[model samples]
Target: MWTYLIHGEPTPGVARLLEGVGRALEARGFRYSPEAEAPNLVLNAITEENPKPYRRRAQATFVASVLELPRFPEEPIKELYPYLVRALSNVLLAYVPGEGAAFLTLELGHYREKEGEGFYERVAERLMPIACSRLVIDNIFVPDLEPELWEGDELTESMYRAGRKLKEWDLLPAPFPIEEILPPEDLRHVKRLYGIGGLSYGNLSVRKDERRFWMSASGVDKANLKVIGRDILMVKDYDPEKNAILLSVPPHVEPRRVSVDAIEHWMIYREHPGVGAILHVHAWMEGVPATPFNYPCGTYELAQAVAEKVREAPDPTRAVVGLKNHGLTITGRSLDEILERIEGKLVRTVPMS
Candidate 1:
């Protein structure tokens, strides 16, 4: 059994948020105990100003301070907590204006035995959300394309159809219109694609030009990517000298880093210009050809290997390359084309090994 404790004074709205979170956990068999027992989680909602120098700050004013418990019992619980935090934060942000900030802290009893102060602090940092605001932009900015150049084309129509198909197939949580989410001036150079997931994993992209593109901020939920000004980051330039990619974000939007797999996507686009859109899903493609090398996700090695495999494929436009032990990366001339290929290959019923 597990328990929870609340510290600090929270407003009526925040109180309700805590209660709702408790109910969510309780439904999963967690119990509440006033006693400070082992295997319990504590929530500290600090309404007043915190004086601590090390307190984490929110990217925007919507959240004042946020802390995550450094410890958990095990795998499932560890995974579930981040989702809960993300859900709660999303709900809170809806009510909070740009000027308002809500402070929250999560403490775990399991780590109490750890002696070093730095140890717990390090743990808390790791558990915290990737960003205070769901939408993040980098510091760079690029010139926008002329409006006349942004008129709908065959590729745009294909992208729109593909977005709808992804939503229909339940790969995207909701319909995301590309035009609405992106600036009109940026539309001509941009072609977008999205995949759904909870707080931890998802993929989205904006092909800026033939050679460059942008991707979703790391760890953002796909369902929350309804609009563009906030949820995505534009890759301005890649510095091979530093092995770094430069990003351009919207004004007033703080720089949120790109996904770990950004390199992989970059590699694909650089190697295959015919591949206009890419869709990565966390499912197996049993019979599809995969990379011979088993590199870990997000590594440059993996990116290079996946791109090499994709390049070798006979049909670059309709290629499906597996990441050895990981998921599948599908590419096509357009999003609609990718969807058509995926629809044919997807197993409607449970898959047997």
Candidate 2:
């Protein structure tokens, strides 16, 4: 059983919202307590007018508000809030104050009865799992690579053939039920990788051994990368002298080329055995360290420059290097470590000048 305390002043609408939220929780076997119970969660809801005019691109005029969890005296509640927000679809902001409390803001429009039920259902689905498990959710956001402006006929044919081969091997899974795991807002990242709506630009790699690593294939939709052999390529036989990076395609499987960033990943892994994973994303991060030179993408010079920067970095295990005018290359000791480092930094596109 779990206990909760509802915080914030109650307006008529807010009161009704709380009741709806309570019913949703009760349906899931969670109980509410008026007394301050140890290990209890708080639901802070607020209703306020939009202080500034909505942006020209904004879809709605009104905004709903959910406050962040206060700094609980216990460490578990304090640590649990961050993971909770990751699964909430309506979360607007999850901010942590340096000296005080951490809070989450959920934006809602003017609340009607139907809307209230939907909102409570969303909140219950996202929060109950964490509340029960008492574990932090480990969902990582890997940004998608932008669509390549040009595609050769041969390349398209090759991808089609590979897709068929994947089907024959029974490697592709059904469309991901992200709603079961994450909130709707978080689904955008998954959709991008699945190629549902837009082209995603990025490559993810995991080191298999000293000789090889597994990486996303060039032109493959990342969102569909739910299964291996169909969505990923095994990169092997790295020969720096010849700049040859080979894929471990099966005996009957048609060969697929590794990501363009393979060489850069190879150079880093070859130099740093402790590095276990690498992620390359196309976006501009405000404060990550940048490479001194801007080399063209998919070139030997670019790979060499990136490797050199990684060697120079104080903490290569968690270092994120900016590829001037291109994107970012991040390395970590393991995949989880890599995800933890790039968690909030993944973005869809670079701003235009």
Candidate 3:
């Protein structure tokens, strides 16, 4: 069942906005659920007076902060980033009574919902995917990584060199500067809640065999990938029961989690064995068929969507597909080949919707 809840006491303006939103959602089969029921989506209504997270019991529960702002700033990304990060919401809905609506995603995707035909319906359509999507970031660490597999292998070296190449091309942008952005108390809360120092970007992976692959570590400097089971980890498979990616790492080493897009790469690699390498960047190119929506990373919906697009491409092994409001995911026969083909073609700035 589709369940949603509007958290907290809504002010006059917020109540008015949510009334329409609730009706639209009910038309689409979503019922108003109480927090005790663990609703699929929670619209945390925050005003200039009070702004805080609802701190729901389930981390998997998607939270979209409905902020009733007096007026939006000229530069929303700069202004909204802090709110979204501090509140730990997946998306931020900035609303003005009769003005308009704008939102920013965890990926820093900022979009505005223009008032027009099906305006409320349009907002519902965009929020539904996010509400339905569940993050697949749980990792079950195994202490049986073979010493021979840690580093010094040909595939591992290739990954390191490729990571450095990405840095040369200025693709591996730094992780969100959470340390510099948030204050101590709020920072501690966010850190404790999400277990994330900062949001990382861009990942590279190479097929190891029919079943396994090696991928970049999350939240690390891509150019300086040195340690195995730390910088680069082997993705053995996905554990459906655990709802986590299975990683094999050295018993003595503390391993960092694999990139959140591990499942997306895993799906593509499993579907098309010919795809020897995969690269995802916060950059874009011309004429690539893109996914209709930007499903958050680490979700099965995103993996399925990207896989379907890759299957439809002329050549699944060497296809370039765009992730709407995000970036590009390119498949190639090798990392070198992908880098070569994308040379002089990638637009440094990813155009947001």
Highest lDDT: give the candidate number.
Answer: 3
Candidate 3 C-alpha lDDT tens digits along 135-215: 788777898778887664787788788888888988887788877766787677765655556677899998888998889
lDDT of 2 at 158: 35
Whole-model Cα lDDT of every candidate shown, in order: 0.46, 0.49, 0.84
Candidate scoring better on lDDT of 1 and 3: 3
* TM-score order of candidates, top first: 3, 1, 2
Lowest summed-lDDT stretch of 10 residues in model 2? 53-62
Task: Tell me how far the alpha carbon of residue 80 in candidate 3 is from the true structure, in angstroms, after superposition.
Answer: 0.8
RMSD of each: 14.5, 19.1, 2.0
Instruction: Give stretches of model 3 more than 4 Å off.
Output: 48-50, 179-195
Candidate 2, residue 104: Cα displacement in angstroms equals 39
How close is every model to the real structure, measured as TM-score? 0.47, 0.42, 0.93
The model with the greatest TM-score is: 3
Tell me the tens digit of each residue's lDDT in model 1 across 1-353: 54445544656755654565556556555565645433234555533233111111222212222233223324422433332233222111111321222222111001111323343233223222311112222233443423432332344344445545655666642222334433443333322111212233436454658876646555555545432334555565666655566665544444455665777788788777777777776555657777653343455666777787788889876688876534578877766567667785663221211
Comparing 2 with 3 on TM-score, the higher-scoring candidate is 3
Error of 2 at 234 (Å): 1.6
Residue ranges of candidate 1 with Cα displaced over 4 Å: 1-164, 172-199, 347-353
